[model samples]
Target: MVGYARGVSRVLVSAVLVAAALLLAGCGSDAPPVSRPSSLPIPDGFTRVGGLSNGLVMAIPSSWRSVDLSKTDFEKELEASGLTGATLEQAKTSLRSLQKSKALYAMDPASQQESPDGFVTNLNGFCQPSVGASADALIEIAKQQLTSVNAKVSEAASVPLGQGTAVRIRYTLPLGKALINGTQYYVPSDKGRTCVVTLSTDLTGKNALFDQIGGTIRPV
Candidate 1:
């Protein structure tokens, strides 16, 4: 179980960073622009990075560096989680594993589901709890932490994840006094587990990046 917990944590953190990287990559700071080849798919001003598959879709800026779970250090952390018997390849596969046995609960706007008062609000009821409890619990914790750090909720929408058994919270963290924006996705795995992705950026001048990359998100 400890190994599972660690594995989930790594997945959550990595996912959030990946999402953030995409968002950041799209944003721009107060600096002169550098020339690039016109053949690139990303617009001249905006950076594009990160994407999703398996019934999920998202795109972020190209400036941020996506965390690579295949790195040896990351693998070591997964192994330290008491999952010595589990190979690094297995850990990576498990991060995105989807379960088909569950379904997301009906969206009940009146179901006491407040826009998380802070970042770390509970997501237990987002989907059926048949998946691992640790995954769900960690999501709640991450939300609270993120909320604390950003102090404002830009957006929050619920969407289906895999099949119908899981759900996700897609939102953005408003730019703070530092002019940084954070975009996040809190997704529950098909087994009713949770995975999170976040992107932080300085969108001072390049607001169009959000417009271009924002449309890539869709419910599974």
Candidate 2:
């Protein structure tokens, strides 16, 4: 299971949105949409986005972009975690294994396990680093940074990975004095060193986004 949190406080939503959009567009797409899902209301300029390895699918408002985790500093941290015999390629392999398994665990941190107003679920897969440091350490650093963004932990749980544990944490993002939802997953390598998959994202609506994304996530 993954932890989730929500809060209501003014933050640079526009900036965050821009950053997210830029990240999502890491791989450019020029083809126009052939069709839109009739069941779902596609926001203006919304584009289809999917997790690179997990095949997790979601639609981001054109204003929002998909970020490639591999290019971020987080990737470097995963590599630095010092997982024994763990390499970027091997870590990706492990991530696919987790996705296929769909392991269950809590998403909220241990300190904030009582609140349950938002959505949470364990994303099936491990995270792989393309380059950089240990993934697990990067995630820890991310957690600390998010706390400054007025985010709070909703749940936290651990799942078994090759030689490490997958840690899931749900954090609440506060914007305009309103609680915005988000979840993050950190899958460390077998040696419990670096994270294979370190994923986090905002819960668009009651985790509707998560459900949409999760549906598309498949093991690479």
Candidate 3:
């Protein structure tokens, strides 16, 4: 999954969020909540966000702001994160590349404001044709790609996500003096596509929180 590698690279570099493409148009506005089984463990106070057309949905912290990647004006948010000049421009470029692929991105405002070097803690998701590859193989590919970038693969296993289980890979990448901790979930979906959900953060020991949020992914 070259797309998965590219997605991971973008997150490591630009600090963007992830999920399936065609997420609801209005970034911060509440979309109609998808009906979910009560047994599913969604975090308290989290908000349900998804795209109506694609029927893919995930829950994010209510405090996190969803960014409409297709929209141009996130300059205020970037500026608020203390980004300026080339770094800011590179980030915008990375985001726009995701936008071109119709991906969904979001970020935690507090993390963004507190980061030492403007690497915003974030999540992003997008769907790509699986072409008959098994979920395990896809995740292994991601693991390899991450390892190539000097990211330490801490864990790799199957976990409940969406309609079935997903292969979850947790890793930490050291960039300069900062450690970026993240998890990527690979869920095989209907119609021969795989849905990828990723979460990256500057804080450490967030596996529980990350899994809790990733577990909420579902295709409507």
- Residues 62-85, candidate 2, lDDT per residue (tens digit)? 433233333323334334433224
Higher-ranked by TM-score: 1 or 3: 3
Write model 1 residue lDDT over 60-137, tens digit each, in one string.
Answer: 343322222323344344344332232324433433221221211011122112222111111111112223444345
Q: Which stretches of candidate 1 lie over 4 Å from their true place?
A: 1-65, 73-147, 160-177, 204-220
**TM-score of candidate 1 against the unseen true structure:** 0.34
RMSD of 2: 17.6
Ranking by lDDT: 3, 2, 1
| lDDT agreement with native, every candidate | 0.31, 0.33, 0.58
Over the stretch 1-220, how does candidate 3's per-residue lDDT look in tens digits?
2122224444333332221111110000112222343434557889876563333568888987765553456455545544456655655656665665455666676665566655667777766554554445555666777777777888887665544566688887766556778787765554445566778776766677787888887643
TM-score for each model? 0.34, 0.33, 0.72
lDDT against true structure, model 3: 0.58
> For this target, which candidate reaches the highest lDDT against the unseen true structure?
3
Show model 2 residue runs off by greater than 4 Å. 1-139, 160-165, 187-219
Off by over 4 Å in 3: 1-42, 53-55, 70-88
